[model samples]
Target: MTETTPFGIDLELDETVAEGHYSNLAIISHSTSEFIIDFAAVLPGVQKARVKSRIILTPEHAKRLLRSLQENIVRYESNVGKIVIPVPSSPGDTGPKMGQA
Candidate 1:
């Protein structure tokens, strides 16, 4: 079943998609017109992490997503306290690097 939101877009979520995937890392790459984001899960002692989901968005949509995330994060921190990101322990341990195409 699909429902129409106030924006007049019909949205549908199947059972499988509703369960969702867990991702600890995201790799972002972009070209002039589009952006590609790969979501992955990395486990301890695992040598390699596989990309579980890949989302491709146009540059305009990607910018919208960035703004939406910034707004939501402000609201989230207001209620749940500030979210902290830990610095890398070593220079070589920098996490999640973005790539260009």
Candidate 2:
């Protein structure tokens, strides 16, 4: 069943979608019109990681997502201390690698 929000939008979640995928790595690529984001899980000692989900958004919506994330991250850090990111071990290694399409 779908629930109507106070703003009069209907939101629905199914069983499979409610049980979400776990993603530790994200690969992002963009073209002239759209942005593609691939979510993957990388396991320790695993040689290869498969992308579990791919999301495509328009350039404008992608920017909106970026802004929303920034705002949420600020609020999260305020409540749970600042999150620290580790530096890459090697010069060739960059954290959370991004690719161009």
Candidate 3:
């Protein structure tokens, strides 16, 4: 059974959607009206990476999403441990060198 929100929108999760996609890197670009987020998986030796998903949101909604992510990250770190981002050896260097268009 699904629960309805105060706005009367029923929230339901399908099996496929619940399984979800895995994205290691995210590319974010924005225009005056909206923000575009592209989720991708960059493998160690892969020549090219494909965008798994693209989500567009208004600037206001993007800011709200940022806040929500920050809150969740904080809670996650508290339960687990601090997440670490390793500094790359050089500028423009990640796991693999690939040209993305």
Which residue pairs clash within candidate 2?
none
Residue range 39-91, candidate 1, lDDT tens digits: 88877768799988999999999999999999999999999999987888999
Please write out the lDDT profile of model 2 over residues 56-77, one tens digit for every residue.
Answer: 9999999999998999999999
In order of appearance, the predictions have TM-scores of 0.83, 0.81, 0.77
Q: Quick one: best TM-score, which candidate?
A: 1
Worst 10 residues of 3 by lDDT: 92-101
The list of candidate 3 runs beyond 4 A from truth reads 1-9, 89-93, 96-101
Where model 2 places Cα greater than 4 Å from the true spot, the runs are 1-7, 89-101
Q: What is the lDDT of residue 78 in candidate 1?
A: 100
lDDT of each: 0.85, 0.85, 0.82
Q: Evaluate model 3: give its lDDT.
A: 0.82
lDDT of 1 at 58: 100
Number of colliding residue pairs in model 2:
0
